[model samples]
Target: MINRIHIHLSLLVCTILEIIPMPISFGTYRPDWLLMGLVFWNMFHPQNMNIGIAFLYGLVLDVLLGYTLGMHALAFSLVMYVASIHHLRFKNYSIWQQSGIVGLYTAFHNMVLFWSQHWLNDAFFHLNYFWPIATTMFLWPWCFWLLNRVRRERLRH
Candidate 1:
């Protein structure tokens, strides 16, 4: 169906956006747009984007961005799996609570990615990995609102 295609397209765009590098000054604090999208998809249509898909997406990201082979995939799959388990809870949480959880999730995701990068080559470790978590957390409210609106409108249509 066209609707399904649109959903996939949206997620793909979000993932591509994630691969593009932002300012280095922003450091590890960059927002996890793909992670956010995965969570959004799982929250609304868990059947569409499950753990397997999350892992695949992670692998693709690693290849596209030249990260360690299974690093992003592993973290992404795990985070998505955990998020999927509590999709309903995410929907029910207050904005503050959701933001807090997202912050923690992004932080952990960044740590795993950093570890994987170093595993691939000793040159990948840096102190900046923590920044992405902070930045992603700051962006969580905006991301959740925007994506939630999209999900709601599509459902309405």
Candidate 2:
């Protein structure tokens, strides 16, 4: 029960971070914080954090960000499905390697969003739209360490 709360709270924080406004200069580079957290939880605690939970959180993010209702939900669910399937292999990799794989996952997520927006809203593809993939990859280690520490502490208590 406590672990579940910890997971949800962490995800909530990530969701909040995702929606916070940044300066125009940096807004284009904003990392996908919620996606990072979802991947982390899916990788580390798949039994508790599965695709369904990812879907729900994605929907929450969609609503919060005023995006199309199911866009984020679908992307997040697909990413989580991939993460959960290969979590054991992921656990064995070095952190840098893990980050690279996470980059691929983030890329996929971003691609889905971009594709959806293009088809649904006739949005133009911009080179800058993919910046979050690099930023998310760069920040993966720190995010992993913080979440791992929190998970340890929570389990210890």
Candidate 3:
């Protein structure tokens, strides 16, 4: 269906943004665009966005980023699960409330990535690592509004 294609296209754009290189100095602050997109679609369209879809998207990201194959897949699966659990309640909340929940979701995603990296590579955890969660939270309102607009104006035909 056209709506399904629109959803996939939005995900594809998120993947593209996720891998786009940034200067190393500012890279730590880059929002998790893909995770944000995943949360949005999973929360708003639970039937269309499931754990399997999250895994597939995360697998693509792993291949693109050349990380361990299942790392992101696992994280994304968990994020989707959490979103699916609260989707109904989240739908009725104001944008600010939704963004607050999204902040927690983003933090959980980051926590998974951080622990996985430390487990796989013995990477050191630092305060700077939390920056992305904050940035993603700050950006959630805008991202939600734009994506919602697209779904309404472009996918509602």
Best by lDDT: 2
Worst 10 residues of 3 by lDDT: 148-157
Top-scoring candidate (TM-score): 2
User: Regarding TM-score, does 1 or 2 come out ahead?
Assistant: 2
Worst 10 residues of 1 by lDDT: 21-30
RMSD (CA, Å), each prediction: 2.1, 0.9, 1.1
Tens-digit per-residue lDDT, 76-95, candidate 1: 98899789899999888888
lDDT of 2 by residue, 1-157 (tens): 7779999999999998998888889988889899889888887788999999999999999999899999999999999989999999998999999999999999999889988999999999899977998999999999999999989999888
Each prediction's Cα lDDT score?
Answer: 0.80, 0.91, 0.89
The reply for model 3, stretches above 4 Å from the true place, is: none
TM-score versus the correct structure, for each prediction: 0.86, 0.97, 0.95
Candidate 1 lDDT score at position 130: 70
lDDT of 1: 0.80
What TM-score does prediction 1 earn? 0.86
58-156: candidate 3 lDDT, tens digit per residue: 999999999999899999999899999999998899999988898898888888988899998999979997898889889999999988997888755
